[model samples]
Target: MTSASFHPTITLPASLCEQAAQHLEQAVQRAVDGAAAPWRAFRRAESSDYTLSVSVVEQAAASLLVLAAESAQSMRPSALRALISVALHLRDAADATRRPTFTTTLW
Candidate 1:
């Protein structure tokens, strides 16, 4: 005899899904804005302040990313993976901005 496997599915209301999607979008936008704030500051900073600005920016971006990821996790499981992928891309872009070859690099 063979055993059958069972998988469970959840059905959320349309309103609930919409609300969740909105929340996720807001969280992601906040993360993006917060991450970019450091870069703006870095641009205005003097050459001697580059190290400090980069350090602060990196920390802020990391914190915002973590918060956004947590928010995504709290929402629909189906969206969590996609949200994480977006976050990873954002982080990669943020890291690239810190490099010497970055187009906006003032140093």
Candidate 2:
């Protein structure tokens, strides 16, 4: 994982985090398996800030997908293990959210 953090100002639903992690992981795996390159799957996009310095909520919600295939192509067994570790960390973090339980009141 890159030092760049995905720290969103607002709490995102666990589902969205999970989906993002899944997409990133799948793309990385495909690249490693020679199915497709990272550049083909990940694209860059630009956004504009309509607000003047009020610190818009949207600014903090940016999702960054960075895949350095140049390095991954030559990754050794240790590197692969590290990659898997990162994926598991992301998955566990996504699942850290608490599930709500509802109780019914008998009339």
Candidate 3:
């Protein structure tokens, strides 16, 4: 768990990154719900047209890229979780499939 590790940040127009996470969670839940729609709560904060944080911007930018790249995508939580799981497993498989060269790790 070093600084280089992947810790995602998502900053939306209405609230902080955490708020965006919460909204995404709710949106996913909504996709599965046959029940009465829960009252969605979002605190509206003025979108700083000029507000700039490099990390937050980078995280949001990455998400935009993923979103833009995908077609007929599922924004649902379950789907996202499954996609992440599959990606992780596939990545592991690919790594395992590789011929280990001491070259990559060689001093």
Candidate 4:
């Protein structure tokens, strides 16, 4: 095949996108100190001292979505943002509602 006929494209694969998201979440977790820092703390995954606050994992999940917008190679930022939002929301919803379907490993 001619080189011009099959030029490499710039679409971000789902796996790479997920890796970028996981990287961003790790950043937020550090930024939030696993949500246990001073002013940026988020509630723990299992804490009874607080009155049912949002989990740091949850906040990190949300922030990761926003962070995905800046983490991927795509046609537009909106596409990234939407992908992040949808993935996080779906995952979060599934976690909250106990409806997860797909399970996998991450590196």
Candidate 5:
């Protein structure tokens, strides 16, 4: 329950941070313009496009982490670290979803 349990600070290059921000911005625009439906289907229980959803989530998480790193100057170090950790977790979760699973087997 203490702040001491937060993840260690992470460092990212300025160029990468800029790229991440740009990618995130483009993704947002795509969603708003109806050019992307990954997120919408992701929220539905009957969604069949798991691959697209996972890919989008992974990219978004990476972009969030980069943006969080870029905001270090304006935010508390501890809070920023927490945000980065959360983004990392989200990215990992998206990666986990990509693993192959057995849905049916002929016996």
Candidate 6:
């Protein structure tokens, strides 16, 4: 049996590379913060208001998707603009689908 592996390479201007790096860092930080937020809330989830607690948790998770869309938009790489747009649309759809409702279904 034979297996194949591929490595891809891309080159961009120094400034663009720097911008992309910054955007990536920001996106990672946002993701980390978004994840931490819900954990923090969960730790203090003894609140009397169940509705507010659920709302906060939902918002925190949704924030990760929003950050991804914003990060892609911020990078604005011409070559990947369309792909980014599609990703943003998908993220939005996911956020919409995850909207808080009376019925909570776990799959």
| Local accuracy of candidate 2 as per-residue lDDT tens digits, 6-100 | 33222433443344344455555645443133222222111121111111111111211223333456668676555445444443433443335
User: lDDT tens digits, residues 17-104, model 4?
Assistant: 4443454445565463332221133222113232222243354455555445445764377756655664565345435644456768
Question: How does candidate 4 score on lDDT?
Answer: 0.43
Off by over 4 Å in 4: 1-54, 74-107
Candidate 5 lDDT, tens digit per residue, 1-107?
67766432223334333433444554455343321343342333123322234455565575566667566798788867765765676576666666788778788
For candidate 2, give the lDDT of residue 63.
17
Number of backbone clashes in candidate 1: 0
Clash list (residue pairs), candidate 5: none
State the TM-score for model 1: 0.33
Clash pairs, model 1 backbone: none
Best-performing candidate as measured by lDDT: 5
Screening candidate 3 with a backbone cut-off below 3 angstroms (N, C-alpha, C), the clashing residue pairs are: none
lDDT score at residue 63, model 4, on the 0-100 scale = 54
18 Cα displacement, candidate 3 (Å): 34
Candidate no. 2 TM-score:
0.29
Q: What is the lDDT of residue 9 in candidate 4?
A: 18
**Candidate 5: worst-modelled 10 consecutive residues by lDDT:** 41-50
Q: lDDT of each prediction vs. the true structure?
A: 0.45, 0.36, 0.36, 0.43, 0.50, 0.42
- Candidate 1 per-residue C-alpha lDDT over 1-107 given as tens digits, one digit per residue, 9 for 90 to 100: 33344222223234323333343345546664454444343333343332333344344446445655667647676666555554454345447665676387577
What TM-score goes with each of the models? 0.33, 0.29, 0.25, 0.29, 0.43, 0.30
lDDT score of model 2? 0.36
Q: How many clashes would you count in candidate 4?
A: 0
Off by over 4 Å in 1: 1-24, 28-64, 102-107
lDDT of 3 by residue, 1-107 (tens): 88778443322343343333343344344442311121122122233332333343333333323432352265666655544443343234334434465666657
